[model samples]
Structure formats: C-alpha cells, structure tokens
Target: MIRFENVSVTYEGADEQHQPTLREVDLTVPEGELVLLVGPSGVGKSTLLGAVSGLVPHFTGGTLTGRVTVDGRDTRTHPPRELADLVGTVGQDPSAHFVTDTVEDELAYGMESLGLAPGVMRRRVEETLDLLGLAELRDRPIATLSGGQRQRVAIGSVLTPHPKVLVLDEPTSALDPSAAEDVLAVLQRLVHDLGTTVLLAEHRLERVVQYADQVLLLPDGVMGSPAEIMTVSAVHPPVVALGRLAGWDPLPLSVRDARRRAGGLKARLEGRVPAGPDLSARPASGKQDPGPGPGHGKGLDGGDRVGRSDGTGRSGGFNPFRRRRTEAPAPAAAPLALVDALGVRRGRVEALRRIDLTVTPGETIALMGRNGAGKSTLLSTLVGMIAPTSGTVRVAGRTPHTTTPRELIRQVGLVPQEPRDLLYADTVAAECAAADADAGAEPGTCRALVSELLPGVADGIHPRDLSEGQRLALALAVVLTGRPPLLLLDEPTRGLDYAAKARLVAHLRVLAADGHAIVLATHDVELAAELAHRVVIIADGEVVADGPTAEVVVSSPAFSPQVAKILAPQPWLTVEQVEEAL
Candidate 1:
C-alpha cells in the first residue's frame, strides 16, 4: 500500500547548507499490516510520516530527490488534496488538524471537503462516532475537549473518509492507559477487517509495541519484524529492558509475555524490598505513616512540609534500590501554594470541584487522571491563567487571580501543555534572551538551561523549526529561568523520548531539592513513578486517591507503570529497583 523508492529529502537553510532529513530510504509497507516507526528525537520520524501524505516537499518547501507512492499514487506528482481519498495522515498535534468547532462537524468536515454525498457523509460520521467512542461527545465543542478526546476526534475525522492507508504520528501519546487500548483496538480492527495499512510513530513503545507486525527504524529506515528491530534498538519499553536484565532468550514486548518468563526472577526477588528514597525523615505532624504497603493516606496539610536540599545531597544514579536520604531544610512560615475548596466552571461544565490541595517546599507532586479529568484546568487555575469560580488559590501567600504578571512570574512558573503557547520569539537564542529579560535573570541563564535540557540545539534555528521534544525543552527552560517557588507543568513530556525524559526527571529532582514545589499534570506513568514523591489521582475534577507514589499507582491497575505491573505483588516500581535488589 505504501512504497518508497530511494527517497531523500533536504530542506532549505539560511547558510546555504542543505542537510537531508531522510537519507535515501527505500522501504515498502504491506497492506493490512501495522508498521511502527521508532527513532530518537530529530532523527526524521515526523519528516518520514509527512512524506507519506505528500507534506514534506509540497506543503513544506524542500527538495524531494526520490519517489514516495501511497496506494499507487506518487506523492511527488499528486498533492495532498488530490491524494486525500487514498491516504489519511494525522500529525503529532491534534489541535492543528481541527477545522470545525464541534466534534460532529469536525468529523463530517473532511467528507464535505471531499464532496461526498450528504447521505454517505452522514453514515460515515455515525459509524466513526460509534467506532471511536465519541458518540457522547459529538455535540461538544472541540476547544473544550480534553487532549486525548481531541486526538480521538482527529483520528475519527480522517477515518470518516475511509482512506486505504492510515498514517499517524504519536496517536496515543496523550491518552490514558484504557483510552490508548481503545484507540489501538480500533486500529487493529481497521487493519484486520478493512485491510487498512497503518504506519505510526510512537515514543511510548510499551503501549503499542505488541500490536505492531513490523517495525521501521528511521535514519537507517530499516524494516524488519518487531522482535528483530526491538532486540538491537536503543529505544525500547521497560518490559524489554527487564527482559534484557533477566537474560530472557527472547525479549518480551508486553507485560503478559514477560510475566510468563519471570518465575525464576520472581523467586530471586522474593524477600527483597525496594530501597527507594527515605520519606521517614520528612516532617509530617499528626499524620500516621502509611508504611511500605499499597494503601491510601490522608493528604498532607499546610503545616506538614518536606525539607529542601541541594542536588548533591540526593542520590546520584537512577538506581531505584539505592539507599538515600533527603537532607532538605525545614519550610518557611508559609507554604509555597495552597488551594482550599477550589471550584471552577466553564459555562455549565464544572471543571474542578471542592479540591483541597497543598504544595509544600521541596516536594514533587504528580496529578494524574483521564484526559479531561480537570488536570489541565487545575494547572491553569493555579497559574492564574484561569480564574476560579469559587474558593481560594494562593501562590507564595498571594492570590493567583489578583497577582500581576510580573509578580506571578516570580511566584509561580507554568509550562503549558502546548509548548508553543509559551514561545513567541523568532529564533532559539531570541526566545532564551526574552525569557531571561522577562525573568530578570542573567543573559545566559535561559540558554544554559536549554543546553542542559537539550544538547547540541542550534541557537540560530527558529523555535518552530525544532522537533517537538526540542520545543518542549525550550519551553521548560523559559519557565525555569524565573526560578519560581512553585513550578507547574502540564504534559511536559509529550514529545520527549526516553533519554530526554530521563534528563527531565533529573532536572525536576534537582529543582525539588532546591526548595521548589513542583506539580505536574501528566499521563506518563513511568515519569510519575520515578520523579514524584506523592501521586494524586483526580477523577471528574475531584481527588479520588492521594498518597505516596507506590501506594496510589500500584493500587490502581489503570495508573500503574509497566514495571510495577510486571512485578506484581512486589512493591517495585522501576527496573532499577529490581536490578539493584538482585
């Protein structure tokens, strides 16, 4: 269905130096097969996906030296509009694909543009709504839909056209575990029942690795079976990592496959306990210790605060079983942020309801839930971007809604879900300079942070020219320049690969040790298990479970990380824990 013949693409550069993104890639994807594209950030994953839909040279000005054919139509000869019936492409950002306000209209808009009959359009729209579980949200505005819901709608919009080949880039990056399963199931049915060819790129391999029949490694653009590619790939899911650690003959892509081969490993770790960071020394007044079991605990009050130590005082490596102690100092007179009975309303919809939360010094709290379960809304309210309909929000003892922009920048810094929302400058250097000027920091402060987060990024390049992961790093650097007491991040790891995410985990840990209170709203379970001291699960805008990381995540099947799921009944949450224990 999809074939590439010695394809190579090069973009125009200001220095008159052209660099090829895809280096003479020759590949073909069979019909009715799901091919997964895997590579590091900026290694041409998105560029390759754009080539399938004729967006590389046609929409994005560049040089196309070879041929890419989708459904027997040459992308070079046929534009995206002409090939719309044969190919459907969904990019990384779902918001960029919406052309209509409501979900129903958005799904039908593609068919309308194709000039399909009214009756046919209606039938396809209904079928797509039921297929993707978007029937209940058909009448809702696209702007109010959650990130994951928006992704589903975007996929539904394309699926309504019934193209021969479906090309998706990170389709399940923002979805919860169950929602991801639903999307994957829909893709599976399309491939099996309808003979639709699916070519997708995803950084979270644990979610989709088992579903793929073939794997395409970018830069090299080599194609092989899933097991063949995953064996030698630098990027892989945690289960594969665990398989390598245990010396399994064949690496397991899914948890079920790994669990069946874990008998001997489980016996080896029978009586071992995860030597995670010490929380016993953390100051908690009038609160009983939840111990080391998986049980819920009461939310900490304003008086109870963890100490803030320097980065040197914390453990150095990623070993989860490494014994370490937090040597942070006591909190000041007031907590960094406080929320009491917080409620927010957008028209008739209640976004947040009666939420009581506190962020003390030197603490990292992760807020997790389904896509539209008020995670983004709560972050916006805390950062003063949205006003609360009722109750109080205080950051550094000042009202967030009433605080001025200058004061708010110093009191709290927020990295929004869309990194582009925080970036406006032309070049990377200019954006860093603006961030430094806005935060009243030294000229090189923001640039240094960017270097620490994303190495080897050119300063002369435009912010939009960078990859999604690089853009996220730049946005994070811009926010961190202010060194605010309370740091708020919404879906910070959306485009980051495993290496980039590991750097982010280390940076956030240092920030937490330096006396900053961090609150992150994310769907990345592995990130929460590694970085957060406390995990808070919010459902329908209310806190459903709040406790230590192991307790909250392990108790719930939907929120647990893959490593925790593989080592069931054991309190281990990461591969490093098991590795160090053995």
Candidate 2:
C-alpha cells in the first residue's frame, strides 16, 4: 500500500554541507503486509515512516526529491488532512496526537473530522475501546491518565476511523508486556483478517519481530524476511542473539520456536547458576551510614570516588581515585526510602491503595504492572509529586511532600515518565551546565554522564531536536548529576535500543553498588531481569507479588524474559547469563 521511489529528504538548514537525512530510499511495501522497521537511535527510521504519512517534507519543512504514494494517492500532492481518510499515523508522543479532553471524545474525534455517520462512529468507537483495553478509561480525561494509557487512547483514536494503512512509531514503547501483546495482536488481526497494511518502527524488537512478516532495516535500506534480516542485522531480538550464541542453523523469531531447539543449550547450562545482580555490595562503615553526600563517591565503581576536590570541598562528578574498605557494615541498616500503607486518590480514582514498600541502600527494585494499574501513581507518590490520601512516604528520612525542591535534590531525584519534563535548556551543553549548577556538582559532571550513556552526541544540538531515545538519555544523565541518595526512574528505557539499554544497565549497576537506592517503574521485562534485584508486581493498586527477581519473574509467564521462556524451568533471565555460563 505504501511505495517510496528513489525518495530522499533533506531539511532546509542543510545547505549541501550535510548529507540528506534520508538518502536514496527506494522500496515498495506490499498491501496487507506488516513491515517492521529497525535501526539505531539517530538513523532515518522516523523520517522514512513520515514520508508515507506526508509529514516529512510537507509539515516538517524539508525538501523531497522523490515520490511517495499510498494506495494510488501521491503523498506530495495530498497533504496529511487530505490523506487522513486513507492513512492513519500515530507518532511517538501520544499527547501531541490528542485534540479532545476525554478518552471517548479523543477516539471519536477522527471519525467526526471525516464526517462519518454518528451511529457508525459510535459503534466503531465502542469496538476500539474494547479492542485496545480502554473501556474503563473511556470516561477519564486524557490529562488525568498515565503515559501508557494516553498511548492506548491515541492509537484507538486513529483506529476508530478504520483507515486502510496504519503507520506507527514506537507503538508499544509506553505499554506493559501484556498490553503491548494485545495491541500487536489487534494489528495482526488487521493484517490477516481485514487486510490492512501496517508499517511500524520500534526499538523493542523482541516484542514485535515475531509479528512482522517482513523486516526493513533503515539507513542501509535492507529489506527481507525476519529470518534473513536478523541473520545479518546488528540490531536484533534476544531470541536471534541466543540462536547466534548456540550456533543454531536458523535464528528463531519467537520463544516457542527457540524453546523447541533449546534442549541442548539447557543441558549445557544445567548445573551452572546464572549471575544475578550483586546485592551484597555495601559501604563498610559503622557510622550512621549517612546517604551519599557530595564527596561520597565510593558506591559506584568498587570504591572509585567521583567528584574530585581542588581544596574547595566540591569534587567533580567522576574522579579516578579508588578506595575500597573490606570491613562489613553494622547490623540494622536503615532503609533509604520507606512507604507505609500508602494510599493515593486522584479525583474519584483510587490510584494507589494500602501500598507498603521499602528500599535499603544499594538495592534496585522494579515495579511491574499493566496499564493504569497504578505503577506510575506509586512512583509519583514516592517522589512527592502526589500527596497520599492515607499512609506515609519517607525518602532519606524526610517526607517528600514536605521537603523543598532545593533540599529534596540532595535526598531524592526523579526522571519522570515524560523525560522532557526534566529538560528546559536550549542546547545540550547548556542543559548539562544547568544540571551541574542545580545539583551543586562541579562542571562536566552531567556532560560526562551523557557521554557515557549516549556517545557521539554533539554539544550544540538542541534537546528538542534530539530523537526520542537521545532525548531520554540526556534526561537520565541530567538526573544522575545530582547523585541523589534515592533515585526513581519511570519507564527509563522507553525509547532506548538494545545497545543503549546495555549502557543504562551498566550505569545503574554501578550506582546500585555505590550505595544508591534505585526504584524503576517500568514494563520492560528484559530490563527487569537484567538489572533488578527484586521484582514487585502491582495489580489494581496493590502489590500482588514481591520477591527476588528470578522467583517472581520466572513464575509469571507474562513477565518472563525470552531466555527464561526458551530455557524453561532453568531460571535463566538473560542471554548474557547463558553466554557467561558457557
């Protein structure tokens, strides 16, 4: 349904000095086929998707050299509004896609724009609400819903119009595992039963690789079947990675297929125990164990202190000085954060109820649940954004709601669900400088973190110009500058690719070891398995399950990682663990 013939896009700012963003992209997507677009963070994947919807050169103010047509309608001549009846597009930021207040209104807005029959619109709206699991949220205002909930509403709004071609960018980035599966299943039905063409771009290949009939690797513009593309593609799912590790003939796309051929790999790793997050690494002090002070840098890298001092009593963020103490800690260490019978009410909704949780120093916790299940509510409560209707929340022994922003920076820091909320500066350099000043750290602290997390990012680039993943990395680096004793991250890996995610896991591990407490409200199961020492499952505003990562995740099929599912009953959580054992 979508065809790009010798298409190339170059923005106005580029005066032949820089190469075109999309160069010589010639491809044709067959009707009724689901094509998966895969590439690194800054590649032209989003640009390619925009070409089909006519958002690239039309609305984005770029020059288009070639032609892009959808269903016999050329995108160049037909603007987004003219093509809206035939094509539906959902971008990364779902909030930007909304034009109405309530969930039901947002879903019906598209059909109303098309001037569809009122009865037909109502029927399609109801079907979409049920299909995307937005029935309960139909009456809720879009502003009051969580990030993941907004994503579903945005998708349902496009889906209600019943367009022939659907183009999605990171459709499942904000969704939980189960909700992502449901949305992908609905897309599968559209492809198989209804014959709708879908062109999607997502970094989480493990979730969508199996659903794709054809895989399109961008920048290089390589297109082929999933097996053929994965065999040579650098960015791939864990199932394909494991197939490469075990030397399997054909890489498997799904867990079931991988499991059928995993008997031998399981046998090889039968007696070996997987290496888990090191939770015993703690400070060797008998003192009150005051949380990570400005000069306290022993926790991150095996006693490699951060923040060097030039006799000013303020050290830079990273220092090469290493100091390790072998002595053990005193008994009865205090918890970094304490939540007792926490109850939060937003309007008429009980966002959280009777929740009890604790985080000691040097521990990582993963909060897992479905969409609108109050995971973000719990994070907001802990960070002091929302006051509790009942119970108490204490971080670093101070009530978050009662603490001042200046004082709270030393005690706790939060990288909110929307990463843009934490950034306001014009340039990347300015953002880092502002973070250093706000956190009272030496210069270059935030810049160093950004370089480590997202390498090759220019200092002059504007935060708004960054890709979703690049922007997220910059936000994370800004938060880490403070060296807060208690850190909270909401969906930390939303737009990150596998390579970027590996960098994040490495950095978080160092922080956890350096005596900092971390809490992640997330839906990435593989991330939880890789970095979290404890997994807490929340459902209906209550903690249904909480235990060590392996025991909690492996028991639940929905939350299990691909390696755990492939090597069944073996307690393996990641391909790295299996590879380490062999």
Candidates in order have lDDT scores of 0.79, 0.80
Q: Record all residue pairs in model 2 with backbone atoms less than 3 Å apart, i.e. clashing.
A: 299-514, 300-514, 307-315, 307-316, 308-315, 308-316
List RMSD in Å for every model shown. 7.7, 8.6
lDDT of each residue in 386-422, candidate 2, tens digit only: 7889999998888988887667767777787777877
Model 1 lDDT-worst window of ten: 306-315
Q: What is the lDDT of residue 223 in candidate 1?
A: 90
The sequence of per-residue lDDT tens digits that candidate 1 reaches over residues 1-582 is: 888999988776522355687889998899999999998777888888899999888987778888898878899999998888888989988989999999999999989988999999999999998887788788888877877788899999999989888999999987877778889999999999999999999999989999999999977888998889989998888899999999997899899999899889889999999765544434442322322322112111110111111000000112212122222344443577889999888766787888888778767788987767788888878777778889999888889878887667777877777788788899899998888887778788888888877786778878887778889888888888877878888887888888777777777766665567789988899888877877888777777777778887897888898888988988888887787788
Off by over 4 Å in 2: 12-17, 284-331
Off by over 4 Å in 1: 14-17, 278-333
